[model samples]
Target chain A: MKNIVIIGGGTGGTVVANRLANRLYDQKDISITLFAPEKNHIYQPDLLFLSLDLSDPRRMFRDEQKLLNKKVNLIQQPVDAINVDNKFVISKGKKYAYDYLVIATGARLVPDLIPGLAGNNNHFYDYSSAMQLRDKLRGFKKGVIVTGVADVPYKCPPAPLEFTLLLDYKLRKYGLRSSVDLTYIYPINSIFTIQNVVPILQKEYDTRNIAYKTFFIVDHVDPEKHEVVAMDGETVKYDLLVLIPPHRGQQIISDAGIGDEGGWMSVDKYTLQEKNHEEIYGIGDATNLPVSKAGSVAHFQSGVIANNISNSVLGIDEKINYDGSTMCMTEIGYDKGLILLFDYSHPPYGLIPSRLNHLAKVFYLDYYFANMMYGLP
Target chain B: MSDEKVTKVIDARGSYCPGPLMKLIENVRLAKVGDVLDLLSSDSGTKKDAPNWIKKTGQELIGIYDEEGYTRIRIKKIK
Candidate 1:
């Protein structure tokens, strides 16, 4: 019997696990098991809505066991190490041997990386932080509200932009738009990493009078002074700060010597196979893919990984390749949003922000909760 | 369309996408057969989603009216 082990039960891992189980169901010799530490699977994209009071945080997650396929065995334990040479994973005190391993541990926000930024600042990267920011926003009156990203290569690149736009809309609705000073700071020169959507987003910011500062890399924060210091000697002060902290892959990947300095696993851009270890595959936020580390990217990568794994098992030389296709719905507030679709071959293109797209995002949330989580078509 | 009166009206004008669709599904389940339900939604997606859901569930879509800022969708509970 062949054992197929998957690590991380997030979007990428869950999809790959379910697809592999369904494809190899007839093959009684194959067994699939998934190791996930968390009991609840969070619909992360909805965190933006949760921050804006558009949705309840309680509705954003469901039990992970209920979402997994019945055919796949799930072990709720944190993986401590991966012995690639022995083809086994060490979780807690036990070890499970596998013929093939798929890593989808995804990324984690490292707020403490930036000194003094953890406690004083508000962030919406996690469920609790999003809830905290929601409460902070309600109590906020009139002052400078600075929303920015601390580093590049963060998950959901458009999230900070979405938050900024939503904040502007909420403040306007509260009749405090004029009293508040809103600013968006980006590490790069442009408002967005995707070139094509930069002008469109800039136009929206301009129309809304939302000030943006470019080329500001966050070095540290002075909580006592209510200021953020940049690496280039620039500083920005705020009464309330919303930050997207730097993100890195799970530490286990790095400890296993399979990840880079940033703890992200290095894999082939198209094939998603680990560079030094062909038997291992990486996808989603955990991999060092030159694409946005968003759920949409994870979902697309799962398709490629699943096909390639199946091909390998069947002794087929042909393999499916991922084109780095990624899409994100940027909520522009006032019940309106837009879609950004791009890939390796194509440049990012913006579909004008409208209420229709907002509805599309809402539809996606429902689909993700009902069908995608369960790995159903 | 004029002959059939709306028995229940779901004011989902300010609600977002699946919000309106979910509300429609919930209310439609409790609605009796031949009862007409009207959903007012500003979300452009519901214009298509509501009708698609109605057709998929074997319900009768009576009419869709284009209002000033929102769309009014009428459905008959056939199932």
Candidate 2:
């Protein structure tokens, strides 16, 4: 049997596993295995909503095993090393060899890299951290709530906006909208990554009266003094600080010599195949693609990668190639939502005011439950 | 899926993600247990999307048929 080992069970890994299973299942020639350190799969986009009690964290999270098919084997253990020289993946004190490897382990959130940010009070990435932020949000009523992106290319570019909007919603619900100050800090100069959605987001910030600090690259957090210090020596004091931390590829990917200067897997923009190793492919936020690191992009890339991987396995003609497809739903507080879509396709296809995106984002709940929760079963 | 109901259709073309499912869900809420909803979807993900959405909500998926440049989804609304 041709063994295919996939690292990481995030959005990219899950989609690739499912797509490969759809074709490789019932076949006698291939065996697919996915590895991750944890069984919990958090719908990251829902984390913003969770802060305001608009969404239940439990409903937005699930066991990774539930999202995967039975035909494939799942290993829930951290990888210690990947000896690319010998073509073996060493994890959990065991070694597994593979004919092909897919590195979908996505990016890592490095709050500690920001100095004093990953302390007891800091909750930036993952479910437990988000849950911590939710608790802090519930108890506190008056404070400067600042949630900002730690660095560039963080997952879901619109996340800071979503967090700001959710905070706006929560403040209003608690009747503290005017009392508690809210600010959105960003390293980027604009609100939206794509220039098209800037006006709409600007209007949202204006109407909600949320402050946007431009080009504020956070250097570190002095949690002891409740201060977020920027690289330019500007100090923003906050009683409640929710920050999106910097992200990097898994250590094993870097150790295996597969990453670029940014510590992310550098692959061909079109093929998603590693530049150094032809036998290795990447998907989701793991690859150094110039698109938003969102689930929609992973879903789109997984489809293209799966098709091409199958062709590579069978020695057939490789037809499908990823055009850097990416889309994300931005929740602008309350029940109002905005959709952002773009691809490598030159025509620039996406819709903003189209209610279709809102419906699409809401439908994801059903999509999650059906396609991910039950489809594999 | 009755031969008679196959003729009954809802023009859900140009609808995007969950729009077809939302409309079907709304129409399904008013439908009898055995009543069928023939949903049409143009969204790319609809091929696996509608059936998956129906399965999660515990609705019965009758069938998914391919039409000219679109898909006709037959779903039975179950409580």
Candidates' DockQ values?
0.01, 0.01
Task: Output the number of the TM-score-best candidate.
Answer: 1
As a whole number from 0 to 100, the lDDT of residue A324 in candidate 1 is 71
lDDT (Cα, tens digit) per residue for candidate 1, span A198-285? 7778988999999998756677999888998875567899999998987878898988899866788988878899998998999899
**TM-score of chain B only, all predictions?**
0.95, 0.80
Give all candidates' CA lDDT scores: 0.82, 0.72
In model 2, where do residues sit more than 4 Å from their true spots?
Answer: A346-356, A373-377, B1-79
lDDT string for model 2 (A1-377, tens) is: 78889888887788788778876777778889998778788777776666666677668767888778877789998778888878889987899998788888888886666787776334435777777778877788777888776655578777777778767877888799888998888654466555557788788788889887865666678878888887667788888777777777778777889875446787777788899777788888887655667878787887877788777777788567787666677777666677666666432245454455666766676575466533332
Q: List the residue pairs that clash in candidate 2.
A: none
Q: How well is candidate 2 docked (DockQ)?
A: 0.01
